[model samples]
Target: MTQQNKIRICVAGATGWAASALCKAIIKTPDIELVAAISRSNAGKNLSEVLSLDTEKNIPIFATVEEALQVPSDVFFEYTSPVIAKHHILSALRAQRQVIVGTSGLTDEDYASIEAAAHDSGRGVLAVGNFAISVVLLNRFAEMAARYMPHWEIIDYASDKKVDSPSGSTLELVSRLAKVGQPITTIPIQDTKGYPETRGAAINHTQVHSVRLPGYIVSLEAIFGMESEKLILRHEAGSSAEPYVNGALLAIRKVQLVKGFRRGLDSVMD
Candidate 1:
């Protein structure tokens, strides 16, 4: 995006944890503008109060997408829960706006629909499991290992009581690995006696062990083993939200540059 042509954006579910962080990121980016923000529970409240924004502009809130889409925006940041993401993203696309979807519940069917919409509208749809640049590089590393090792497994970690068994990051990584080939073997933890399902879920013809503990933001390690040698690639996210901000900005700037939907964080990346 050029300096003069600021990318106008609206962040849906504006009061949530990730959406609030996204709004703050948009606030500081010179190349982007928060044209609109919507949150039903926080309607009529100030972004400054909820997110501690220093700027003194009267930012109005809307109760729903129907209200928010009355005003147009260049791009829409869809950051609600999985239950609402599919409908919210489709709403933005129907409004003829580009999208940067950060929410996780999108299945393959949902993606196919978004793909059709993006192609028909001649806009871009960018979906990312995790936006950290180091995570992107870790995926690249896994892709590279697939070329030679062809024997890597993915393991992703999250907090306990998180309902999702396999993480979106792990699913995304294994999906990429699927583009390469089937792994050599599959290990089923259910066959073991201790902890039963404690070893985690499996995906893409490979073993993906899920770890849920209290103190982690998000972390993953890809393990490749063969001939008495092993390759490991790992990335850990700190609580600071700044790293993800740049990628979000990148998606907003680069959204209109593509013709259709993009599945991975690396697709629209330069």
Candidate 2:
């Protein structure tokens, strides 16, 4: 492809684990150009310096998303925190740029607004909680099972430092599962006994439990119960961030062909 044909990409949270990995992938991909790296902490430094890549290419790092938008880019990749994910993505959409958001924590209402904005702006935003294909399949299968099974719960496992109670993947799974079936229990929360908190938060109609520990990288489990048997679907991730890279890249490429906000990596997988 010619220079003009390449996909120009800018990354928010360039210094983050997932964004840094994505930057390297963009650098190596022949069809994608890493145009800007946005990191407040390392704004003035070259991306190559911050990433410790051997390449001498001086990719300018911007401290803010507003500043980075001055340079044109086809896609804006977001790997930041939830605190700013909504603002960054909305800004990118208003700028008429396609976006891929890997950051989590936004509520369903936030996504509805984003979808409306994307529709008005005629841009696309693809957001996925866990980009690993396995997790995507796990979610899909659980959703399928939810059509038949009436009772299920989500268990999210992550490292202790993970701020979010239920990991993004678990939330995504629960949300999707909730859509397919009604809540298994009809009892009011006021009637529940002992520690109500132990029952976990309700997502859609399903209860989701979060477990954070030191050794765990991240894991999500969807447990379904029936009359005589129980079924469990789980996806676990190691310390490496490689699992997310491929799915994210796929979203970047697919977002160009989409309009409005889209959710789930499985949307593009098919």
Instruction: For each candidate in the order shown, give its overall lDDT on alpha carbons.
Output: 0.78, 0.86
Q: Encode model 1's per-residue lDDT on 1-270: one tens digit a residue.
A: 675588878888877766777788777778887767888888877766677875676566787887788776788888777777788788888888888888765666778888888888777788887777898899888999988996777777877856665666676788888898887754445667777555555565777887889997678999998888999999888877777877777777887776688767789876
Q: Indicate the worst ten consecutive residues by lDDT in candidate 1.
A: 195-204
* Cα RMSD, model 1: 2.7
| TM-score (C-alpha) between model 2 and the true structure | 0.96
TM-score, structure 1 vs. true: 0.89
Off-target runs (Cα >4 Å) in candidate 1 are 1-4, 186-200
Candidate 2: where is the Cα deviation over 4 Å? 186-189
Which number leads on TM-score? 2
User: How many angstroms is residue 32 displaced in model 1 relative to the true structure, after the best TM-score fit?
Assistant: 1.1
